[model samples]
Target: MGSVNAISKPTPVNPRLSSLPGESFPVCIIGLGLIGGSLMRDLAAAGWPVFGWNRSAHTVKVANRSGFDVSGDLDATLRRAEAEKALVVLGVPMPALPRMLEAIAQHAPSVGFTDVTSVKAEVHELVEQHGLTDRFVGGHPMAGTANSGWDATMSGLFDGAVWVITYDNAKNRGQRGARLWLDTWRRTVQMAEAVGAAVVPTVARRHDSAVARISHLPHVLAEALAVTGDMGGPLSLTLAATSFRDGTRVAGTEPELVRAMCENNREALVKALDEALALLQKAREDIASPGQDLHRLATEGHAARMRFEARAGRKVKDAPRRPIIRVQPGAPGWTDQLSSAESMGAQIGIF
Candidate 1:
């Protein structure tokens, strides 16, 4: 924390990245919002030179006050990244990514590009449109709260959390920078692990669908729950219990952030919501049936929820942390062994 400029080529935190000699290459985070600012702080703490760019002057002031080397000039930052082949992490909103992707593609094509957005397939489209699929790996660090901005960020937030990294070697190996792709993967995992996240390799579409059910749907439901009850009622606040308070916790997240996520990936979210609705309907019917023996839905729901909670706490012992699912543009049946429909191919062995 003394001097950001005094950093060195970071040591590899994991054996898989042992051969990646220290280039002392810095990482440039394009946004200084909660995720981006936290990443910069953690990377700098790990002895990697870190630079950041943010649009808001107040945000820049806050970052500089926090001792981060944030620049208001994005063009200069991108040029610096070009010179060092520094990895770029885009932590901006989903809609802002395409323009930034195009810029990174044109100005910093040599460096590896990744993101912290929950949605993937949309960005995958932007990556392909800009011919950046090879140089960019889609990512989502499952570490966040109902907060935003630098002050809201916690440096150790990602600790013990799941960070999903997308992998693909579908590109022809003959491409000029094909080998660098592997280096990018190593550096990405290395940096992610440095921040205390347990890396999980997954496909983009698979990640989107799983997050839709596990993450996105929860936000929508929480917002609805928070708004459904009468605020005017005198007993409304007094009647709330731990369940009510905990269930609507995510409703406190910034409206824009919630809106962006729900709007961007609504297709997948709608499907998950539909399933949730059907299950609720079944439970409703079962509750209406006075027969104690016909409460099958309730029993199934309890067991299902318990099974999820069980796996959520268990870490894979022999599971390979490297690329678990490979995604190629037209690779036939790639999903056959890797679909979330089949437990998200979590059992697929890493080669």
Candidate 2:
């Protein structure tokens, strides 16, 4: 996504929103690991009613002791979500998604659905298989430390992060049905913004592809970098400094979590890995040749890094103001219109 060129006036909310749940609806988070636990803390601190569920009894106990509304009983937790008309966020890892979706289907069948999973396409598929797509909006927050579990969770983890929201599985649900999805979307955008995260609307497939290059591929590279560093033996370990440490930072993440994140987006990650390997192979060939140098790789890499910095260094307040693009849910091609605007870097205004 790039900067939007068109700036317009604020669009009015869809009239249908008046018939749906109010803004004060609670949040029910499933899986109290880092992402979910942090969400529970932040939402509660911001004064939204929030509760959560974790499979581990010890984690639930720890969270409860820390004054969070988390429990070990899945059924009881989902029952409360239904009673409270909450927006449900699944924060389980990719390997655990199917089982979690099954529980959601059997327990709280119709609540607003979303997830904090690293991958989106698979989640979109599973949500449809479980008959939850009508209310589903997939999400991934571009934030996390090389940490996991309740003990590793902390507040402000999502602050200033780009929270990608996907609508790839959505359909033309007519006017009344549109209201349901729209309400769910609004609530999600509200929650993300409340936590100081920018909501970046996109389709699931694109989100997965983009993250594979910028996120999953980095994890793979980091793992390889860390292994390479170790192969240099004791002298390299003692002499390692900022560059080596920074490059391999994510390699320090829990191995299973790293596997789930990278493997879940296997197709995209493999393509990204192939591209990266090509570059490394070229560099190796250059090293073998007598007069050749890393001129091409270094120049290209430097330009790419500069582009990223130019885009990242621009603060939201520093950018030219642009109107939030509005979409009439369930209208003909409404989702398409939203997707197009998102490609132009426009934020989908909450209805």
Candidate 3:
């Protein structure tokens, strides 16, 4: 693995220093994929100026046409961000994080940065090793569709989603700069609220474990289902129903990205799979027995699913403050929707 070299350390200023109210900050997004593009849309709609960069010129062009200020040159984007004292959002893959940090330290040292990568521990270590800890935060927006790329982005993608922010104990030690961070948090919360997702706070390890169970495990299960059905005759597959289709939905994900996430988070995923297998084995054993309490187990599974749904619904309702921006039944013009939100005292971010 490549390592980042340490640079000169800055004086230990209080990390918890307060932020001024209504202060506008420039944001630099390094990727124009689904998450980055959606973030840009939300930030721009909320009236924040944004600068975007992508490895592909075509991606940048598409973002520019969609009303984002995109730069094809990485150096130029860094220069622009340094000039504006911006917050840089890294939306690259896990394996790309070390090099990205090195590049940022070399070209954009003055800008504060954050990443949207799913796995946090390794990336967090890289940021610290590069002596950019204070100026960086780990962000993982818990929202996305099965789609990828800028063209798949929608302004409401993050609405009502939990965007996890992770840091070392150092960053959250005081309440001083908590408000400034909260301003950024508030913007993200509003974005989630607008999209219909609930915001939840969690530590990195916790986030990884939870997602491994709910998200990663499901992808694995979907792949297993798809593979099993492949062994069946074509006629059998033709008779698959809605539940079969839905259950195997994520099996169609981009192969590379899915493989990367699974490999990177293998430990947590393995543990989750073990637990799931144990439960399945118990169910199987019960079904094999003539006098098995099949009804009880079925009831237990149903009750568990109901509890999960209820908790998820309650969390969504409790996460955000009142006065959320509501979208009508039909798709309206972007400007008109934004204007409506602004009039209702809702902060909206559009990229």
Candidate 4:
């Protein structure tokens, strides 16, 4: 639970790493659950060898049985990655990141590393503390369902997803290494494209805040809805429909992870909740008044939801095609222009 110096934007991939041959590298994924197992399937299908390990022997056996190269020994897993010059992806929960990074630093110092933790600030700090900044990148793929475990994983999970990458661009020591990292990202992006996800850029703080509004807050609200709707009445429970179930679906997530993420990002989440509460209070007041613009809130919410659904549908249909507008150098006020363009559905290249 340490602090990481916040990075403002996505760093450009190191030219050096990009210059390497288009050869595949072995990848070691720890924790053969949803994220890890999905990664293993995609990478293996892409012609890259994948090794995996999990705390549960049954999970490891399942991965192996499913034709993945898996082992139960942590050191053995690291050794395999070291022998193959591969990146070890830590796909476990946030609480396990520090210990996993420590283990990697001590046992497999030379291997490149990354992770799939939703919250990155703490994990980034842990990697820095281990002096492995040059060899690691913090990653979070913005895709998942209310599911867990190796059995639940699929190859198409990350298709067209925004995979956030956070790193120390200020320090130029890993420029060449960063390129390789991006090459790996290109593969991930391709997978996302294949699966109907749109690649987007976001820093750790921005990601946390945005997710708090759309993802985290929904979970909290859903749980609240479920609790308020049913007070031990079978009739109330039986009356639930698709809309009600969909609205409260995320409430089914592991409570411990929900608690951890909420506690870690409490500040941003609190602000989001407060804003939502204010809007709700205003709506209630307006509804009770003689001449209040209650319809304005309804209109805004309807418009927003429509826009979101439209964008989601477009992203799914356009997954196979590369972004149309690549951000180029020498454009006047290119940064602002590109941002504006992207907001309007133009796909700008990631620099």
Candidate 5:
């Protein structure tokens, strides 16, 4: 990565390239799994001529059979994207990101890029190594079901969802922070917001660290709890109801995905796990006491959950809160001359 001495409009360094708007530039989705298929569906429905490619011939056949424009040839897909000045969104699993990056680097080195992959830091690093950050912005739509593949995909899945964008806003950084100066990056943000997703910006490492604690850790804990409860006997499964089912439902998600997430985010997840164990230990100690301590913990947890729900709604107070003052009849500032109700009302033009 190189830095510019001064701020400048981004150039392709290859003069023929234009910074086209996302709508004018076609979108070539390199994978048609859950997130990719949903993106393809929504964009095509919105009137953008979308193109798709996939690793599986069966998946390609399924998409083409369903009346989508697609091709299995990686080279052809890259050529069309280059001709159209398209943005390519990689929607494969975390494990597949590297191979796709390698292919894209070889075939379409100049095309703009983003991904719907959950992990960020590693992908950002890979993009830098390929020198593709000039045309790449790392993105993760913080939306999904615990489901996988094309059949599980649906439109409007990103509505009202927070789309985490990993890019530095700072200057002085070149390839790694090209997102700051690139017209293509702005268009990508617009494209994401156009899909009814709110874009939240942060650096790649920060995105990964936050996701590990919030997203990956929960999946880990859910699977752990499900297994722990079942250790008692087969009867435990029969006894499981709403609470048990809802709490551990993610435990049934594709094991390969869970394993990949855990492995990729091990460091931050381990830290989150340590914090969770400390809290669990505190809960255990409080449960032994069973009256004040446990009650207080539960009360605090309930309050936090309520606060979370409240904050998730629209119209949260984004500005700093201010203090309010009330003046009464007997207060120090009160003067009998103006304190008369009629006199004050007349002065203030109020009744």
Candidate 6:
């Protein structure tokens, strides 16, 4: 209900904290769901200027009681953001984006904008639709659990997680106003790193495509797997163990959230789903025909899993250090350079 700065928290001296123009830019997060709430917790804990908003006054009260500055009033929250020059983060679901963006455009049009939305391209389109592109940076933090709401939130959720910061450079193809665009990108990256996340610079389309397979498709598969396990009946349910739990972990996410994630990224998800179906169809055919070995599927799957484990382990086990690659905004082909570096597993070290 109060301004973000109304509560004073000393900024912790952290090497992970990137040097911003103002040292620490205040973050106003709208929607106090799991991702937003967890972000608020981590940023506030790290001594950054942060506050949040949720439509539910009860959720706001809970966050407030837990010492987070939160407002249930959208207009007041945006007013504070405008007054303090805060960077506004949209943490609501895809279905709620339009209304949130409209309110933001009306109340705090000049503030820097970013989001933790699961899908990036659609959000980017919506931002562009509302003429909020100038100070906007598309972002999606690749973290979260099969949980929802304020109570499900926990600090450090993004610790060592891949927090994607997206920029479609083509949008700035001939524009001279790269400073604000670049600053927005840097601010989002700084905030992500401040919460112990590794920043991956990318474009909105690529982000959507990649997440379709890695993030969204998994939810679809998990739902199918869960149902298959349930169809196995009482004995099978009783005997289900690690594999079932691991495979269906994301199936426990709020159904509406899963729908939004998959439905919003429909095109990419369909492509991913088609590929998955092809693989399954081959397996089915192999099983139906006697004497046909499942060696190809089994071997390829094993190798793929192994490769993933190796890559993921390296990322997670690596020491928390600043990004090693730097990309300048206005430089020629800088966006392409960042994308190229990202392809090689390099993160943005300096803006």
Displacement of the residue 95 alpha carbon in candidate 1, Å: 2.1
Cα lDDT tens digits, model 2, 47-123, are 56899899999998888888888888988888889888899999988778888888877888767878998888988
Say which candidate scores most in TM-score. 6
Error of 6 at 165 (Å): 0.9
Give the poorly placed runs of model 3, Cα more than 4 Å off.
1-23, 169-197, 313-351
For candidate 3, the per-residue lDDT at 228 reads 88
Model 1: what TM-score?
Answer: 0.81
Best by lDDT: 6
lDDT of each: 0.73, 0.78, 0.66, 0.66, 0.67, 0.81
Residue 218, candidate 3: Cα error in Å is 0.6
List TM-scores for all candidates, in order. Answer: 0.81, 0.84, 0.75, 0.77, 0.76, 0.87
Q: Which ten residues in a row have the lowest lDDT in candidate 4?
A: 10-19
Steric clashes per prediction: 0, 0, 23, 11, 0, 1
Weakest lDDT window of 10 consecutive positions for candidate 6 = 13-22
Candidate 6: segments with Cα more than 4 A from true spot = 1-22, 169-176, 238-241, 314-317, 320-324
Residue 322, candidate 3: C-alpha displacement in angstroms: 12
- Cα lDDT tens digits, model 4, 1-351, are 122221232121221122122345567888878888887787666455678789888987777777888888988788777777777889888777777877887778677777888776666677778777766666777777767888789976766566565433213546665555544444433333333345454445666777788777887888887787777578878998898788777777888767876777787789899998999999999989988878889999999999787556443344534344443322445446445543454443433
Give Cα distance to truth, residue 153, candidate 2, Å.
2.5
- What does candidate 5 score in Cα RMSD to the true structure? 15.5
Residues 95-202, model 5: lDDT tens digits: 777788888888876777888888788888777787666667788887888787888878877665666665442234465444333545555555565455555556
Q: Per-residue lDDT for 1-351 in model 1, tens only? A: 644443543443332322333434578999887899888877776667889798888888888887889988887888888897788999898778878987786778688878999888888888888887777888888888777887787676766567787765434544555666766766676677666566666777777888899988999999878887546365876798898899898988888888888888988999999999998777777777787344677678789899787557433333343234433323455435445423543422222
Worst 10 residues of 2 by lDDT: 5-14
Q: Give candidate 4's error at residue 66 in angstroms.
A: 2.8
TM-score of structure candidate 4: 0.77
Give me the runs in candidate 4 sitting further than 4 Å from their true place. Answer: 1-23, 167-198, 231-243, 315-351
Q: Is candidate 1 or candidate 3 better by lDDT?
A: 1
Better of 1 and 3 by TM-score: 1
